[model samples]
Target: MSARPGGWRRRWILLLAFLTPPCRRIVALGSRELDGAAAPWDRWRIRVHRSICTGCRRYLQQLEILREAAHGSTDRPPPTTRLSTESRDRLKRRLRCEPAKS
Candidate 1:
């Protein structure tokens, strides 16, 4: 172990990380926002989390795409709406690569 143990900078980083919600929670918050059921705190958390996490940013984009498709369906005939194989695989890969929660 280093003598400094990362000092104050590292301490702050760890503290911020601890405060930040994990990817799973962020995803849930994003979904809630999409549904207009999110609290103000949730919106702030989602905004902050997405700024640092590419996987979650992509996931939210995918969610938006799905939402728009769902809304469009209400105006017309409803067919099976599904992600394309590539999108599904990409999403899976991103989720898999994310760091696990403590």
Candidate 2:
């Protein structure tokens, strides 16, 4: 059988399939700002996207997991959390008494 017409039809079908509402929705949501609360339109867009797109839903779940993990660690205090002041004379005396490295 001749395959030219069949291949052309298949290509059109695949292109239209990729342009569907759900795919567009997911693309919009995936492109939104990830760091903070989205605007009203963005919120709606994300809602629609998540409702239709399983992959984006899973991506949101993974994002939440990573956010939780990022916040879970860090028991140690920062180095600058404490402050100390010593007299310059005391520091100079200590330095003078110390032996020099060879």
* Cα-based lDDT for every prediction: 0.83, 0.64
Q: Largest lDDT belongs to which candidate?
A: 1
TM-score of each: 0.55, 0.42
lDDT (Cα, tens digit) per residue for candidate 1, span 26-76 = 998888898899999889878877766789989999998988898797677
lDDT of candidate 2 over 5-102, digit per residue (tens): 67986776566445444655555555454665457766666665565457777887777787777677455457866334556677888999999998
lDDT of 2 at 6: 75
Decoy 1 TM-score against native:
0.55
Considering summed lDDT, which 10 consecutive residues are worst modelled in model 1? 74-83
Best TM-score among the predictions, by candidate number: 1
Residue 19 miss distance in model 2 (angstroms): 10
